[model samples]
Target: MGRMGRIIISVIVILGLLALGLKGCSTTLRKAVFAKAMPGSYFAEYSRIHPSLYQVSGQVYAFEKEFARSMILRTPDGIAVFDTFDTAHMISLKQTLEQEWPQESVRWIVLSHNHLDHIRGSDVYPKAEVIGHKDINQLVADWPNVNSDIASVTREISDDQTLTFGDVTVEALYMPFSHSSTIYGFHIPSDNVVFAPDMMFVDAVPPFGFPDFYYPGYIRALDRLIAVNAEHYIPSHMDRGTRADLIAFRDMTVEFQGVVEDEYLKIDPEDFIQGIGMGDAIKSAYDRLHPKYGHLHGFDAMFVPKFGRHFGGTYLGY
Candidate 1:
């Protein structure tokens, strides 16, 4: 190759290495580090058991799979499901759907995001029309394994979109970069229920160091969810909650993030490499936030890692 061509390739290689280096310092990396030190309980990674179905008012029911939750709405034409949670969870969900309403087939599988956790196993309902945000297509190209692609999704919700069939209307509002770049928070106006994936916790603390959460977008998304005035709030990671519970969690998370951000900003950006002021930030955040949020579920468990997320976010400029 020519000298100029070699130079260009070298620059690309250097940039790629730098990107990888930065990613090594990400929340996922930190979580992994902690996991090794404090090895967590072992469980079936793909196995789901003792699935419980709760009637959330009328034809709308919530299927809680171990930890993740999916929603089912029975309509005159067919049933509509929000999120599949992977094959094992989907299989149970499908069984419950068939048992409750034998005649009605699942017509629609509305996904929360393109994340494998939420979008997997749509093939369990092959005939059902799969839908997600316009950004869903990015996974088609980005996911390395062609087999893992969300290939069933044909319908894409680009704007404030709604799917209506037999008195059930599921409105999806795209909240970009809140958690996933293309996650859609679903609101069922008639049912007064909202299915927001990983945005807010009901009474629990933020897990995995707020992984993939873009702070600014996350706050805006929380506000959007609160404004919905949903009587029932179903976060994927938690069971069910009321609008009051959702508001409480939202306020706590916002305040925690704000304090962490302020503490981190106290340090100069250039001196971040040494992390000289990090100890003070941690102390200040703990002192200011612990009194208010300590009683919340999993607060003691997730306190340290969750608070450090903002500093990591700041360093990464997310």
Candidate 2:
């Protein structure tokens, strides 16, 4: 071979190898692996907040004042609220709903769970028929200093419980563990929607928490909800949504479940060694997912200790 030609060929081969190595390290590859790890099948549709609703300080973590107060289900009889803002913020949300749907009253108030964010504002809507998981009442009852306004009409809900109010039919599906003992989602069949609180944090990964409870159950509940085929899955906190979001959530749940199961299934010696690194897998997943969903922590905030305890991780390692 000619000297210059051989040199040129060598340069081409080197460049080709470099290109192939870079391809494996590309952000696109990372994203693809992340997607496989999460297995999301749908995209959440994002839009500007509806004019009728606006944010209040207590509605979200103090940092996010832009989060809307509640999801208003407007019907001819009245507006059915998915959840009310914290007690301090409910008066304004009630007033705003009244101003927009002047002829209607707040007919129903569905509590997705017993979380402060879900039930704090129960007092403001005096006439609404309150519905929630059966266990939520116990959460309120256990609180020695429970707000006086929430004491009434705090009905216990069960799985398959159907609530018919005017044109709306709300079906409460019990979603226990993970976040709370009595976590639940309200399905609005007429609208083909489900009001899911905390189950799908959308863009945020949850921090650790107490009860040191069942996360696999959370995945099961999500799977059950998907089996119901609701087109719109709205969260009690964010208060807006679509069916595709739930589908994506389903895919993500499946992926996470697979990771956990796969990690747990390793043979004894490998299991002990790899178990130590599972935390890294969890963190890597979170780090990759965080950029897209970091805003999640911006809302349903949790301390690292609670998260660590909840996930059984020493810290954020897994």
Top candidate by lDDT: 1
Please give the RMSD to the true structure for each candidate, in Å.
11.3, 13.0
For candidate 1, lDDT tens digit of each residue in 1-318? 346844754565455445546653566655544444341321232134358888886767888876688888878888788888778888888888778778879888888887777777778887788888777767656766743524557887776787786688878888876887778888888888888788767667766576878888888898899899877888776546777877887788778878988988898767667768887888788789867776665565466678778778776777
- The worst-scoring run of ten residues by lDDT in candidate 1 lies at 37-46
Task: Quote the RMSD, in angstroms, for model 1.
Answer: 11.3
Predictions in order: lDDT? 0.74, 0.54
TM-score between candidate 2 and the true structure: 0.61
Question: What TM-score would you give candidate 1 relative to the actual structure?
Answer: 0.80
lDDT of 2 at 114: 70
Model 2: residue 254 alpha-carbon error in angstroms = 5.3
Strongest candidate by TM-score: 1
- After superposition, candidate 2 runs with Cα above 4 Å error: 1-69, 145-149, 209-213, 238-241, 250-318
Segments of candidate 1 deviating more than 4 angstroms: 1-49, 145-151, 268-273, 315-317
